[model samples]
Target chain A: MIENVTLDISGERFQVFYRLRCEAQDVEAFARHICVEQTIEFPAELIGDDDIRRHVMGQVVSLAPLDDHSWRVVISYAVEITGFSLTQTMNVIFGNVSLMPGVRVDRLEFPDSFLSRFKGPRFGLQGLRDLVGEKHQQLYCSALKPMGLSADQLAQQAYQLALGEFHFIKDDHGLADQPFAPFRERVSRCVEQVAKANQQTGGSSRYVVSLNSPAEQIVEDAIWAKEQGVGGLLVPPGIVGFDMMRRLADDDRIGLPILCHPSHLGSYVASPDNGLSFYALFGQLARLAGADVSIYPNFGGRFSFTRDQCLEIVKGCTDPMAILKPIVASPGGGMNFSNVQDMVDAYGKDIMFLIGGALHKGDATVPENCRAFKAQVAALLRR
Target chain B: MIENVTLDISGERFQVFYRLRCEAQDVEAFARHICVEQTIEFPAELIGDDDIRRHVMGQVVSLAPLDDHSWRVVISYAVEITGFSLTQTMNVIFGNVSLMPGVRVDRLEFPDSFLSRFKGPRFGLQGLRDLVGEKHQQLYCSALKPMGLSADQLAQQAYQLALGEFHFIKDDHGLADQPFAPFRERVSRCVEQVAKANQQTGGSSRYVVSLNSPAEQIVEDAIWAKEQGVGGLLVPPGIVGFDMMRRLADDDRIGLPILCHPSHLGSYVASPDNGLSFYALFGQLARLAGADVSIYPNFGGRFSFTRDQCLEIVKGCTDPMAILKPIVASPGGGMNFSNVQDMVDAYGKDIMFLIGGALHKGDATVPENCRAFKAQVAALLRR
Candidate 1:
């Protein structure tokens, strides 16, 4: 059936190059286990058969020993196998083998044939900048926090933030459709307040509400957000499937800039040699999955990401690849006003600094705190 | 705004008790970090506010030091916060903290009020038994594999296995609507073949096709599968969202026995001191999402699952809980016709033994191998 199975390394098939840490194990046996577990879970004899080996089994392109105990193996699969869907592509890459210990997905290589399947980001870096009308300086984004606040209270906070120097105001990932503030009511009020603030300040400040709900409702709410003319939409691809983000990006009816939040997704990258690289998980994959702005925790912040990890995330967002455009790397979670200069130096221009609690701190008002954070970043641009 | 926030530990709120391995660290500070990361990503001073603390903050119910390093911490969240949705529930439990190291989620305790939102397993153990018409014996399931085979060839294999003894015939998790054999054609042919084989052998073999596809296509294909009289439907909740399983389970119109496959979800359970427990991920969560049968890798097999982990999965599947019915605990991956007795001894009855490669091995034909597998399990019952 696989009459024209290509063995050429530079072929059209999108490849997932996995960097597995095979500690003192039989490299060949481990490779076979990965190949069989991922693709054809059949007998050895059947897999040994040339036809099955060529067509179905994953092609082991290269295997190099990293140390006495680890091996850096590169295995490539035909794009036809994955059907170019993000969900199936992930299954082919790490579905069954995820059960195995010490195997990490360090690199992912996708040909244009595969990349063409996804819309990537609708309003990518340039488009988002164009929308905000801030072409020169780095962006400042913040989330409405202390989630017990009612819809009106949250909206008032959003208004205050918008009145300040914040370009993007978002609902905290925890602020789902609860009794205190339902989805429709919360989204409507917040968007309206930001709009009012935008009109008063004569600045483009967008309020992106979280659209993470049930599947059908996800689409419905996204459409409703578009209808309401909300500046952008926030979706947690970690909680919802990554493919759902692609679907949202591809949907012509719901044309809105998407902000992808990393909630319930840290397990994939927390381990050193088990799950995924910071660049791959938060950067490349998030961009490919149609995240206009990818929000993760800052390095000096309360979260456990290292400075190098943060830099890699930035590179992954802006790295030149195929036709895919670069996305905004928005880092937050325990970020404060004091660290803005250091963060600006670390991430440079084209970054979105997401400071939450710090913007609400100090003797000054929330807007004043926001102004100070913005001024600090703008001063760095002048330097 | 938070009118009636409860401080009582014995309230209707759901609690997730995590056994974090914080080595020689400040236990209270670490606990507050988790609480803040999971809920309000704000300042400690803001969190210390009584109104915000009582209403929004995740309460540290108990904290006890373990050994020189690790600590056992119990945290509780208001059920109203999650809105009783599975997506929101997971977010509240581990969303941001999953990014942090050494924070393993050991226990999850949900009240009946929270659990009542989900319809756990429609058919369950007894319903599956009634469907197969085998009341007392253990179920034998097989995957039609070596994925490159055409639809006709795979269907022929399914027919052979059905004629011999397989109670449940499923597509391997890898087999999506690939170019070799598209989903609709393969599913239609396999169902017809199994139905024909069932008629010939006077057996009640059920062909459960994999419905792992795009979101919209998933619902459409489920409807199509029902129209084609498919016996059961298997969904990979890992690839799609867990809420998709809930959606499929809640759909009364389709009403096919749903089998939840644990593909692309291993990262959550691979780490010892992080992510989720085996019982919670595979057992409790799967059942709550409406998995009539939950499939996971068996211990003493090709996979890395330990014996204790496998047992916990069984306990999770069959544990006593509200009105939710107990589902079948299917331990699979690299199982064989030889290990039937050992598995029976370990899991006893009410288990589904899924053997793939081994069934296709030995001098016996595929059907003969299936027959031998069934006989081996049946002989255990004779004891």
Candidate 2:
């Protein structure tokens, strides 16, 4: 009976390896609980019903004790159970079991058929490179910040950032449809200003406006950004569900590149032993959700992300997959001129250098600061 | 310059306290970084611009050392910044800074005007009691689980649970639209059986179906469930989103009481110092998102939630707010019939005791097991 559910690697079954930390006596119960919690939530007697068990039951591939307190529980589920639906797939992965503590989703291995169901990335690393017309060098990105500026003033900053030759200018994550600077007005003005600056400077800089709105209005805003010819759209998938990003990428009506922001998502990666790995969260999940660029905090910044964590995020973005195109791992948060070369040395040419306040420091004008920031990247790449 | 942006409690200013763990030298910079990261993204020179600083800047309230490595940093922003949108409110609370590690949201205090902008809960504790036609006892709830069962089998279980005079019968959180028991068919069948059993037993048992679907289809499913005349709906806001729950609670067309499931939400409360408090995640946030019954893992259960944490969640559910009504704090994970009295003693009459496997255990039939569970609760309350 136990041999009946033997996992066929070529078959349409998704394997999810969960690191379940529990006592030895509790290990068996924990493993069984996860099987029931992740798949069927009924009596074990039902598993005796062969038809029912095969359809809805999850089989524990193997369970071994990692330590006295923790056990590595590997479980596999039939892909048909997920219905090839992204939301359902997520539900299948961490639905009820995510409620239980010490059960971390260590790794997720999807069958080719399962991965094929998702439209990975509309514009990935190379596509983004082609869109910006920067094929060889690392990309440059900046943020339009300080929430109270009127649409005109914010546009002026966007124009300045573009003039400095930054490839992408994003709205700070905090910029929503506030009373001071409304969404439509700010996005329109900034988009226009970025266009004008690109025309003047002969550059292909993009203004990626924030489209973090209510679910009903999010699509409308995305379409508006496309109509206004925004370079890209920044979506905080953590606030808006990840599936929303997939929908955006799949919708041909608004087929613009997406920059996934990591807002309200720190808890998942804060604890190393629980939740998701940095590579999985920022890299794999972002790419799966159709992010052209996954933005995270860079190391040696005010943030707590270390160099190793940042490297994992990079691997998750660029690692080979079935058909999912690689995406850029854009790291920001406290980046400056002083460490741009170090960042370049660490990430090489595949990454995007996201500098914020460091570009504006010292006595140079905004455009001069931008030029200098661009020059720093160019010099490092040339070397 | 600081006086220009005075903290006006009457003028809709929301205060957020963050526990920033950092070295002594980094505290001031961390405080300033959060202010800029939250509001204005431009340089400090831009803050010097009276117009920009007056409207868009967040003011640092106070900073005090918590320990050798942590500091309590209080920051306030003008309510106008959030636009009173739940999505935006969450962004304002923990947006770009969520990428930063060790900055945990300790507390959130909102002005009445700000809190009044969004609808809280449709049915609180009293309303739910009124809905279920129960007046003077702690309510009892069970799950129709072990996912491999067919729709007819699940309906039979629902029928048996209702016949036993249980107050509520909910689909286990794992029951999505699987082929074994599709959403529409399973929900329809379960609803019919519960209604049939209620009529046969002269009872008012409600079957709360799980409506966790893709974003586009979730609303459609909710409407379908409502059209079928289901008692209540269980939504995993963590999988969907907390704001999406708010949207559902606000929509009049799908005006059904929501049972917010804590699936994929453990990471937020798993760590003591890093993420959200249990009360914040399960209680206050759940109530704010319109969860009529906020379900969490009970203390001394198979799950890791502590007794103190469970008590805090109860307070979060029933504690006084401006207009947000008190809701039922439903505790479930690892709960059994044997510990029903202990649960009652711990949580009292205002709580909803959610027992699952224990209800189906012993020599009794499924219906007989349910009756024994009801008897135990009755015995405890009658004492």
Expressed as tens digits, the lDDT of each residue in B1-383 for candidate 1 is 22333232224666777868775557788987787778766665654545457756788889987767788899988787786687888889888888788887876888876787778889999999999998888888888887777788889989988997689999988888887788989988999999999999999999988877876578888888888978888888887888888788878877889889988788898787788889888888888888999999998888889889999999889897677899999999979766777798898888988888787776788889888888887788789
Clashes of each: 1, 11
**Model 2 regions lying over 4 Å from their true place:** A1-11, A22-29, A42-46, A49-55, A63-72, B1-10, B22-32, B41-46, B49-55, B62-73
Model 1: residue B137 alpha-carbon error in angstroms: 1.4
**Candidate 1 chain A — worst ten consecutive residues by lDDT sum?**
A1-10
lDDT of each: 0.82, 0.81
Docking model 1 quality class? medium
Please give, for residues A47-69, the per-residue lDDT of candidate 1 as tens digits: 44455576567878788888877
- Model 1 vs. true fold: TM: 0.96
Query: What would the per-residue lDDT of candidate 2 be over residues B150-258, giving only the tens digit for each residue?
Result: 7887898899899988888999887888766788999999999999998999999999998778776888888889899788889888778888888888889988888
DockQ per candidate, 2 decimals: 0.59, 0.52
What lDDT tens digits, residue by residue, belong to model 2 across residues A1-383? 11123222223678888888878888878787777777766556634646446546777889998888878888888887785677778888877666677788776788777788888999898898899999888898888866666777779889989998889998887888977679999999999999999999999999998878887688888988899989888988888888888888888888899999988888888776678878778988889889999999889986789999899999989887678999999998888888887798889998888877776667787789988877877887787
